[model samples]
Target: MAALGSAGPVLLLLAALSVLSVAVFVARLIALRGASAGAAARADWLDAVEGGAMPGAPVGGGAPADRLLARAAALLPRRPAPEALTAELEAMGATEVAALGRGVRTLEIIGLIAPLLGLLGTVLGMIQSFRALELAEGAANASILAGGIWQALLTTAAGLIVTIPALVGAAILQSRIDRATDEMERVIGRAALAAALPRS
Candidate 1:
């Protein structure tokens, strides 16, 4: 606690950013995990839709992918051309992809800024060390100068500690987003193909 105080305000800011990054990561993980877990169910739903069991109304309450597939299934029967229908599905899927990616850019920003904040702390620490030496005139107090430098470097280390994990978490979350997107495309393609087929 004392060390953090000595490291100055930038350290506090980085700490807060670290907390926010963690929260975003956890929320995204839960959402993506839920979507992935429901993959098999989504596939089953797509198969049913292709079998011509269109629901009487819009289906509600399922994974994001399932909901998107349901919406596309409802829209498929309107007999839109395959190209136009595919384009519409892609647009809606893009929206869902964007929703899954919320807060990801914030995490990326934190990762990029944390290291710069650490460098700033290093500069500030060096300034304090020089100021201490100047105060001592010809007889510089080595211990005090070293203490000041040590405290300053603390913020840089803290910044790295926060940055590495935040960036790693962001990467992991991005991969999940990509996976979800691919699944959505596949489901949409299946629905579109079904719509293009002639009824027996």
Candidate 2:
């Protein structure tokens, strides 16, 4: 922390961003975990729908696929138009996908800006070092220039340290959300198909 303080505000801000990035990733990870049922359960739900019955989800209704299926089942008996059912399920799926994607953009922005912040810190450090050298006049030594250069370089390294994990976390979380979205579409589309409620 003291070292971070010495590096200056940009580095300190980068550290705070790193902490925030990890927190967002962890929170999203926990929220996305088990957010979809296993494939077999999904298959069973589709089968039940096709079999002309409204079936309860194998587990909780919190999963995206489960919610979408519930919506379709609720509308099945009404015998709504094929286009209407498709539209409704698609709308619900969009909402679910958007909810899953929350916080992912923050991770991406942090990953992108961290390196730039590091470069800014490096530039600031270099300016201070040059100013010190100018003040020393003929008394300036190699150590003075070298020490400043290395200290200035520290921000660059710190920026990369923050960037890699944030980007990787964003990628992983985004992939999970995408898979859930696909699942929601598949389950709901099949349910709509089985009930003869959609054009496919």
Candidate 3:
């Protein structure tokens, strides 16, 4: 607590940002877990679509890819133009991808700024210590100078501590998004294929 007290306001702000990062990570993780499907599940969905059997009604509570397939299937009977249907699917896919990516940019920004905030704290601490030395006619005691320097460095250390984990979390979340994106594309492609098939 004392160490944090000495770390300065910027460090406090970084700490708050770290908390926000964790919140975003957990929320995104839960949302992605619900929305994403494994390879086997995806294969099953594609097979069902190709067989002219939509996996489920266009209701909620399925993987995002499955939900998209169901929605497209619902629209198939109207026999909309191939290009028009494809365009609509593409737009829906973009929306799903966007949903998966919410809060990701904020995490990335926090990861990037934390280090610079720390560096700023370090510079400020050094300046204060030097100012003290000057005030003391350049005869400031060693302990005073050392203490000030250490206190200033505390923010830098705190910044780094917050930064590394935030960056790792961001990377993991990004990979999840990438996987979800792949699944969405595959599902969209299969839907398009199903639409192209000639009716009996």
Candidate 4:
């Protein structure tokens, strides 16, 4: 496009960085959504299994939590020791929770690095503007200088746009994970206690 062609090299580089930032943001959003949804489903499944209800036909074939719940229900009745049963269930929950928490590290890294990238872009743009001014034989062109400064500002805005939401999303997902973990601990405790009781 004519407009894009008019953009200086520094602006083009900033645009590329912005695009990359947006892509990372989108990926993180998808990961967080999946983690929250999966955790919710796992909690529901655990609750139903603990209440002695069987899960319905597998949705989209089957989920890992569903397989785990089924396995626990079958083995737990035959397993004599409550500690062993609890240990197995805890292990299963740990793995599922770990999967849910994946991509959190990437989000954190992006949040911390995006601002720095923006700063780098800003510095590069300013350096270019200064070089132009140094080479100018006569008065510096205000329009050219303004354009470079605007590009730097735009890059900073782009970085914040990517980072602020990612940081907040990571926090929200983390809280969801914590709540799910608490629910798991309670459910596992109840199951262990019930198993420890003597048969009538």
Candidate number with greatest lDDT: 2
Itemize residue pairs with steric clashes in candidate 3. none
Compared with the true structure, the alpha-carbon lDDT of candidate 4 equals: 0.61
Each prediction's number of clashing residue pairs = 0, 0, 0, 0
Give the winner by TM-score: 2
Candidate 2 per-residue C-alpha lDDT over 120-169 given as tens digits, one digit per residue, 9 for 90 to 100? 88887788778879999999998777766777799999999999999999
Off by over 4 Å in 3: 1-6, 38-42, 48-61
In angstroms, the error of model 1 at 37 is: 3.0
lDDT of each residue in 9-117, candidate 4, tens digit only: 5345545645655566566455544332354555665566456654653232134444454555566556448898789888988987797676666667767877777
Candidate 3, residues 60-100: lDDT per residue as tens digits?
44576776776776777766666777888889989888878
C-alpha lDDT of residue 1 in model 2: 46
Error of 3 at 193 (Å): 1.2
CA lDDT, every model vs. true structure: 0.79, 0.82, 0.77, 0.61
Measured with C-alpha atoms, the lDDT of residue 5 in candidate 2 is 34
Q: List the residue pairs that clash in candidate 4.
A: none
C-alpha RMSD by candidate, in order = 2.7, 2.9, 2.7, 5.1
Off by more than 4 A, model 1:
1-6, 48-61
